[model samples]
Target chain A: MYEGVVQDLIDELGRFPGVGPKSAQRIAFHLLNSDPADINRLREVLGKVAEGVTFCEVCGTVAEQQRCRICRDERRDATLVCVVEEPKDVLAVERTGEFKGRYHVLGGALDPLSGIGPDQLRMRELLARIGTDEITEVILATDPNTEGEATATYLVRMLRDFPGLTVTRLASGLPMGGDLEFADELTLGRALSGRRAL
Target chain B: MYEGVVQDLIDELGRFPGVGPKSAQRIAFHLLNSDPADINRLREVLGKVAEGVTFCEVCGTVAEQQRCRICRDERRDATLVCVVEEPKDVLAVERTGEFKGRYHVLGGALDPLSGIGPDQLRMRELLARIGTDEITEVILATDPNTEGEATATYLVRMLRDFPGLTVTRLASGLPMGGDLEFADELTLGRALSGRRAL
Candidate 1:
């Protein structure tokens, strides 16, 4: 429908996770209209990413070098490690400004149907860090989905024998600023069963 | 929240039309995880687009050479011209397989709020082409919105002085696959006004 390279560009843009054909066309046109410098900047960044993003050797999060910023920061409590599903989850926890601990990114949750088991994720690396770093507590910060829950459960079993290491899961309840009526029964049940006194 | 170049890649991806921050991050991660060949292919296409695209000398649609495929084809009706607002609209009309005429892309409509007017568009070039092309009919195929209507109305006035030229507009009625009950009053009124004698 368009010139050769223009159509090609649109097709390529459409391959992105959430971009539809219309959005691909829109983005292609946007790139066409953008400054050459801007386009080149994006291209340069992509080229660098293609070269590969380094992951931290300790906790398996994205890093510029062998270790991530959090792993390298001496101020953060290394004894407390937050276990999560992906590198992105590390940022989600960091955004809260509440956690003063380090992170252990598991690459992804255990989805046996998808063939992603303990061997596929960074679970071994996480366990090794806990054993060597004298980590006192492990907080399961995985998403509250089926796969996440399953991964957390498996990790609890794996960490049960680690002496003096406390394991905890994130609390689930009605979200702040959300209507109670809108909360699903499962969440409402969790909130009821996990009730705490002030 | 990410490494230097990785975060730069995410920021660049976010600049694409319709891609929000989360989608940008997802795309960035996808690119990071994708084979190097895929990233390079997309990059190569963007580079070609950044080099610049050629517009048809005759119809103002995207073209590899002096004229578009439709304008260059000898079989198309030389005496009929389809005036559209963008190159994408040419594809829309072509997809219907109903029209066999060349196109005149106005680039955009009379969007005065955005500082677009007759002079800003390809109006003068269109008039010049009509003077020399021996065109007998002009089909106004702009969009159905306010700006498209204004441009179509303006073109009608411009083409009126040419003798032997028939100016026509694409019909304004309910779309073929659309439900009449779901249509707005304006569209329903247009449908009533432009009812064909079947």
Candidate 2:
């Protein structure tokens, strides 16, 4: 423990995801030793972010206004919607520079064990958007885990009733530049089953 | 790569020690998704810590008032002073519950390459404290690296001029439960050199 305010700062920092107690102490001390101007800047930015940032009305991604940047961009393919679990996933997909479609963040994947269901997510908004927007394809880009698979399967079954809508899942196989020997059984099996001829 | 305020939050989080860009984005998004009440609490705590916390005038440790808790406690041994590089080090030593003395934080170890000399440290305060107080023993508890060793050597040389003052360094040896086979050469050598008769 430390002085009252120092301990309070460490406890607050420890609440952040992935920061352990040791890391919290280190960061708290670092901030304490840093320049007053720098600390003020960080504080200003944190307060500004809390007040200025909000969820996009259309797609649930983080935004400064009613709509996120991707949703506001008319150059992106409106007919194709990439459904992801979180806003962070939107950034992950964007890093490839391959997907040029709009995104719908589901807030989180379905984990019945954790009490997360379709109604708990933004599934209702997603369905409404799909029906109103002239979307032809919906790509499920959730994580490759049990919760993600369950969410995708549920979506696929529900979207089946849509007359012209097509649904697809991102391919799961060996990663680029990865060795075959080190690949896991499920990934190696998927790669074998989805093999292509040279 | 993100909306205005979101990107600003990420950039600010990335400035923290050991937090990379990816971690910054993750934390920013996590904060965005968290309840506004929680975010406000964190912000309040940060502001409170920055405004209220001040360095102890007696020992240079973190405090909310003029002196630190340890320095204010009359029951502690005023005649023994443990010199460390940072306030965090004081916590580490206190956790051991072995030292019942006061502390003197040097701010940082002597690293000439980093332009940190004796003048840059709280060395003047330490010398003044020793001269004024009835301190009989000074323990050099700096880290066991080049900078720490350099600082200890420098302090020992400087303190030699004082009469009837005992100077000591913390014992250097293999850590508890550490395996001999895995021990580095330098550590093993120190363990051998500092071997006890028990």
Candidate 3:
């Protein structure tokens, strides 16, 4: 019952993850009800990101110029580079206020079934950064899934012979707020397997 | 390390509904790692939606101009208006290809606790449309929840005095594919309370 632009918006919104037909329509209506100025701001920022944003040549992170903010930060620990399967992992880690080191964004985890391999990722660039920079430690921060484990294993083997390079993986355990009884078998199993000395 | 623009994109992605901290970072990284042109396209569309869209004056559905296309169509049955709470409801009805009438979007349902009242809705415009137009029947297609019920009741009472106006509400009960046993008590009660003879 709407104009072409409204329909176009609904179509576009439906493409987002978890936004079904009904939800898409709701979002479209929300946009329609909102002030044009506010909507335009979102559009403008998105447009700018679309036109001007790009990947950092060094570590495969998004950037407007040549390097990403974290990579360029002078205060970050250059010697400790955290490797993650995706860009979102970096943000999650950062939000915790725990990490003050640089990052290397691997486009994706090692999905053998999906045919993704070492060549598909920016592995060569990661090796280059490790070789040239004064990086003393490489932290594997990929997800706890099979693909993540495979990727981590591959990286560890690849960097085994490199001098002065210490490879470490993020610890796996039960979540802080989760109960021991309700924990899934796999997670509880992993927590048990990766147990540490007191 | 990498660049700052990628980090900015991740931060923005985190703000979307259902996008967790990790997922947001992943999407941002994916966009950064992908071709610049693709990322730019998404941003451009997002920005354009924010800037270029608005609600239709007559129907409150999303539109590029004064009225939605359905409201503007001369051949549509202005006499049979389907009233819904949101623009998304319009789409759901449209998908069925059954109704041949126009629509009146109420912006939202009645929620007293939330402080929403008749003043907050486009009730004036709706009444005006009914008064001026040759509307004969109205279908109240709001959801079955309390807010939707209240909105429908409010409309029914508001339009009761209009001459030759047939006010009908959409039936509520079990979904077509749903198993009766699995249905919650409330839905089962509605199905029983609204039962009809064959």
**What fraction of the real A-B contacts shows up in model 1?**
0.80
What are the per-model DockQ values? 0.75, 0.62, 0.36
Estimate, for each residue in A55-170, the C-alpha lDDT of model 2 and write its tens digit: 89999998878998889999999999999999889989999999999999999999988999999999999999998999999999999989999999999999989999999999
Better of 2 and 3 by DockQ: 2
Candidate 1 stretches with Cα past 4 Å from truth are: A179-182, B177-182
Candidate 3, overall lDDT?
A: 0.79
* Candidate 3: stretches off by over 4 Å: A52-82, A91-103, A106-120, A129-157, A164-198, B1-23, B33-60, B63-78, B110-120, B172-193
TM-score ranking of the models = 1, 2, 3
The alpha-carbon deviation from the true structure for residue A58 of candidate 2, after best TM-score superposition, in angstroms, is 2.1
Residue B74 CA error for candidate 3 (Å)? 6.7
> Candidate 2: where are CA atoms >4 Å away?
A196-198
All models: lDDT?
A: 0.91, 0.91, 0.79
Q: Please, what are the lDDT tens digits per residue for candidate 1 over residues A29-137?
A: 7887799889888888878878888998888888998988898999999889999998899999999999999999898999999999999999888877877887999
Docking class of 3: acceptable
Q: Please tell me which predicted candidate would have the highest DockQ against the true structure.
A: 1
Model 3 Cα lDDT, one tens digit per residue, B16-89: 55567666655654554456566555555556666566678888887777888888899898889999988778
- Highest TM-score model number: 1
